[model samples]
Target: MSDPHLTPNWSTSALLTIDVQRDFLSEAPYGVPGTTEVLPALARLTAAFRTARRPIVRLYRRDGQDADLVRRTLLAGGAAIVAPGSAGSAVAADLLPPGAPPLDPDLLLAGRPQPLGEHEVALFKPRWGAFYRTELDELLRGWGVDTVVVAGCNFPNCPRATLVEASERDYRVVLAEDAVSGLHDIGRAEVTGIGVGLRSVQDITASLTFQEVS
Candidate 1:
């Protein structure tokens, strides 16, 4: 008894990755544990989307005065947690295409998206959800996207918020489970409860390749 609405429509799908900045990767300040381990799979999904000529959007956090209470405290205490224009605030190198311009922190913080590749762009998420105070929803709508394949650094915060909000907005949402970090059994059950279909990196890339062939 599969949920028809939950099935992935890859042809109309876009990939949205949340909070994959270097500051969230290993060996960086305030890096989330387990974020470093999932890079390979995340990279594969990114590359596959590029090859498929589908839209890819990278959402990163650039903490500022508008940052959340916890982060604001850290920022006030002299923490350079993804500080604007810092190398540590840029997307993880491997997660981006080669020669992609460094992220424009000013542009992002001002609520504008910066081009990353021909079919890809990066934007800043001021809060946990990508759609909050950002152009993400409008961008996807203008591109005629109704399905979003989500992956990235952590599941509990940004990824989870993005998925739930995507569902709330009536997009068919699929989680590249193996391509995101901070996931556990309960989290899996939770996402499924919200009708987020889960797939591995292999499944997503293979499905895209199959679509291309057919």
Candidate 2:
């Protein structure tokens, strides 16, 4: 690792926006509290990443007929919000670009990338971490990405899980504090101890100019 005083140089980074779907943002289903409160910040981060020409991957969850359906059913209490092709399975309108490309739930549910924005692709994750059971590692490696800028919903669950997995794989990780939710103080402390940079949206935005889109 480079010296800790170097302001965390990111040679190549991908913005991994995790589980910020309709269900998790509002009352659609399985929504977390405080998620709605961070809408502006999340939008700002998304714009910044797009401007910086960094790769942005939208991590989505889709339900399938898996062996663990019984457990998922129990955890969901028999109500499925993020099921494939469901309205709640899509990203929230606020987070999506105006006239963004449509995503085929089936393709992503099968663990594929669906093109979204200029340099952004949407990938369906079978579980919390984008690295688990997905081609995120190969994709990042192919693009020569080194650092991961993570933002989105429910820090205690998928967000936290994904960050840990990224660190284990030797990627420099930065968690945008204001762009995510569901983080308790203890959890925040734990992430910081692992060398993850916890920064606010405005501070991150200030570091670079956004790219000019045609």
lDDT by residue (105-168, candidate 1, tens digit) is: 7788888989988889998888998888999999999989899999998899999999999999
lDDT (Cα atoms) of all candidates against the true structure? 0.89, 0.79
Model 2, 171-212: lDDT tens digits are 888899998988789988999888788888887666545222
Top of the candidates by lDDT: 1
How does model 1 score by TM-score?
Answer: 0.96
For all candidates, what are the clash counts?
Answer: 0, 1
User: Which window of 10 residues has the lowest lDDT sum in candidate 2?
Assistant: 205-214
Against the true structure, what is each candidate's TM-score?
0.96, 0.89
Q: Assess the local accuracy of residue 190 in candidate 2 as a C-alpha lDDT between 0 and 100.
A: 99
Query: Can you tell me which runs of candidate 2 are displaced by over 4 Å?
Result: 1-7, 67-71, 75-77, 210-214
Lowest-sum lDDT 10-residue window in model 1: 1-10
